[model samples]
Target: MSTLSLPPRLLMGPGPINCYPRVLSAMATQLVGQYDPVMTGYMNEVMALYRRVFNTSNQHTVLIDGTSRAGIEAVLVSALEPGDCVLVPVFGRFGHLLAEICERAGAKVHTIEVPWGEVFDPQQIEEAVQRVRPKLLAIVQGDTSTTMLQPLAQLGEICRRYDVIFYSDATASIGGNAFDTDTWQLDAVSIGLQKCLGGPSGSAPITLSPRYVELVRKRHHVEAGIKDSHHHGASGSRIQSNYFDIPMILDYWGEERLNHHTEAASMLFCARECAITLLDEGKDAVIARHKLAGDAMLAGIQALGLQPFGNLQHKMNNVVGVTIPHDVDGEAIRHTLLHRFNIEIGTSFGPLKGKIWRIGTMGYNARQDAVLHTLQSLETVLRQQRGPITGTPGAGVDAALAVYDENRQ
Candidate 1:
């Protein structure tokens, strides 16, 4: 059999983008025993590192050993008891995902939705919260399917007013966007490293407020295999999923070091390096970089006479959705870019499937060179296709360069 080989494609898609070199290197470091002093020390460091990443002082911050969605599930399932009410505002695909997860967790789910390209206003969410009076207000801070960012600063205060636990999945927007876990009064937040942390998708960094901790801990049950004299069960109903029991996971991560599952050491290293890299660069600097690259990509697409999907004002700083031209075959264009240029962009889901292309400037791919290369290559593919499509030669690259130039000055 031939050796495993894959093309070195430039990932400019919605996520699972290029991992930072340092993160890749970190993952290659040899593993130690799960409970080794060195491994536990790294685990502690990861907890400490993610506190800064999440911008919270909450002692419950830790890593979930799965993708972004696993983090979402762990937070929701642990927090919501059977028949508890949850309010979810849907503006994009991930919003639907939040609602579905809530339903699966046996929560009575209430939903408020807007058009796919538009986000719900704070008042609309507030009105729903006022009417539904949910036990938990769950939402997505950034939904890549529509490339829209829901404004969260106000909703936090609204949840606080109604005495509702505010939980958000910032998987798509955390590192590249402005997320303040403490200032926003968020009760629980989960994020993946792939998007803007410049790492592969496996480890999820999550934070829980003291309020959230107290709520979930009531349902805590020590695994029978690891139960001991000091362990005690809570009065609340036991959490349904064994793997997602946050309280048990917290004990494993906490000073108690009670065994949960074998820690994913390589992923732990990757998460650590991702966080260290971001902090070294500085959070604001990394955000600014994403914003600059995203702006350039936006300018490039518009200069090529492409209309962007969604409300530009509410668009996330890391990804943009371009409306597929009436005459252009979106898939064919994507095919040429992937095969010929070895560069990848994203297609949308749900309401936007085949209607818009999602181009991302995120993590390690969020750079001027990557943006320009994508624009120039896309211009080539568009021009080669036969149709009513028309754009001034080099206009896309020129426009992007102008954005960089202006930023430099």
Candidate 2:
């Protein structure tokens, strides 16, 4: 265990995608006291940094101390009450996850499920809302399991007309695609650093709109002195978990500056750096890079006679689902790539497991070399395993090269 050293893998997988070298460096900086002026200064900057990153003027911008799931839980428990109904438009695995969480929170969960690789239209969601009159409309913008990106813009406007709160988990596609929290009327959105943001897991950036804030603020009465006085008020009902209380989180981020847990300093550092890097490159430019990488990766795979998995038009630009060849052991090929080629890709989950491979070109790894190398390595390994092949592996590289050149020119 002491000698364990992992290779610098080309991470072409679902997520915790390759973090930027700059982010890694920032995480390694010397630690400061949790409440030290310098550390809190950085924390304040983290809020500002992610505000720009999220493209919102939301005053409730802050990071959760846990993974993306923690952020999701925080929003659900904070915004929901017992007996409230929530409409979830399920197109992939993550939507089911949101439904499950809401169910645990005692929400009357209503689901509108589609095929694995499909997404809902605004009309379908409106129909569901018509049926349920849900208090909240929760869905995923991008579901990595199926490589499908459910459109959010139209759903936002529709939900507002229905008096429903809108929440989204953008963990899989936030930085890689076009997202506007304010203009889209999202009540709340949660995202992780592990994907298109180009940083590690263990933290999630969340944004909340003022209307949503006021709605949840109804639940915010926690005073030790008068704890038992208002049994009828919203706060009288204990939140499922104390660790994820958003009113408390808000107090910590707001001028109250109340002490909760000592913040995750290093994670905050890395998140700040990731957002800064995004801003430095410009969000539009970073998205354009992911677009190019996705296109090149798709072109290369198609050149190798493989078909992409999903509705090509609706797929997230950061991840692609590829059909696994008939005679090839998908696991063995992935293992060989990890051991020999020093690259890593992924397979799918649940019903789609082993049927498709998910290759990612997200965050810092969305580049010419990463895309081309993954295609070339996959081709070589498939050939050695006596898997069916097309003309030449070099052709895939050349196709990607042409794309890269075209982009530059």
Which one is best on lDDT?
1
Tens-place lDDT per residue, model 2, 1-409, is 4998867877889897888999999999999897788987988898998888778999899999999999999999988888899999988889999999999999999999989988888899999999999999999999999999998988889988999999999999988999999888899999999999999998989999998887776773555545523222544355556688787788787776788778988899898998999999999999999999999998898888888998999999999999898887999999999999989899998899999999999999999999988999988988888887686658788888888999988
lDDT of 1 by residue, 1-409 (tens): 9999989999998998999999999999999998899999999999999999999999999999999999999999998888999999999999899999999999999999999999989999999999999999999999999999999999889999999999999999998999999999999999999898999999988999999998887774646655432323455566889899888899899988988899999999999999999999999999999999999999999998889999999999999999998889999999999999999999999879999999999999999999999999998898889634456788999999999999999
Give lDDT for model 2: 0.88
The list of candidate 2 runs beyond 4 A from truth reads 1-4, 220-236
* TM-score, structure 1 vs. true: 0.97
RMSD of each: 1.6, 1.9
- Highest TM-score, which number? 1
How many clashing residue pairs, candidate 2? 0
Q: Relative to the unseen true structure, what is the C-alpha lDDT of residue 301 in candidate 1, on a scale of 0 to 100?
A: 93
Clashing pairs in 2: none
What TM-score would you give candidate 2 relative to the actual structure? 0.96
